[model samples]
Target: MSVDLETVKRVARLARIAVTTEDAERMTGELNAILGFVEQLDEVDVSGVDPMTSVIPMVMRKRQDAVTDGNKAADIVANAPAAEENFFLVPKVIE
Candidate 1:
């Protein structure tokens, strides 16, 4: 698809960018060039190519989904003025 001068000006206005008529005219050509390049990319044969997240071949590191209470409860409450059973005992605030 090709971009026209009006489309460029409309897009600029929608994006809240102030563009003069000359700039819009210039951007219309530039946007058309970019779209033409993207269209050319669609013509390439890439059915054999596999999509990947990284360039380097590596195994994804994974950990076990084991559930645990994360034994740091006692350590976290160590600095509290009053803590019992790995819990902080706070004074009642509501009347």
Candidate 2:
């Protein structure tokens, strides 16, 4: 679960990044620190917590699932070169 100097160099090469020796050494320590923090997070107890979409307690906002024509056909075709009956008229591509 730790990032080493060799791993850093290998990852940089795989990502097509030019990592100088000095940059790779620096990144090795930085990446190890990040992994260490993530490992610490795994120690927390969350068995009682309910999964939620947001941190704030609130019900999910919802809308009716009724289906209908969006009523925006005319607006959608307003900028077309030729629009008829709220439909875009395109040139025939094949004979």
TM-score of each: 0.63, 0.61
Tell me the tens digit of each residue's lDDT in model 2 across 1-95.
98888999999999999999999999999998999999999999999989999988899989999997798887899899999998889999998
Worst 10 residues of 1 by lDDT: 52-61
How far off is residue 78 in model 1, in Å? 23
* lDDT per residue (tens digit) for residues 1-95 in model 1: 99999899899989999999999989999999999999999999999999886899978889999999888888899999999999899999999
lDDT of each: 0.93, 0.93
Q: What is the alpha-carbon lDDT of model 2 when measured against the actual structure?
A: 0.93
TM-score of 1: 0.63
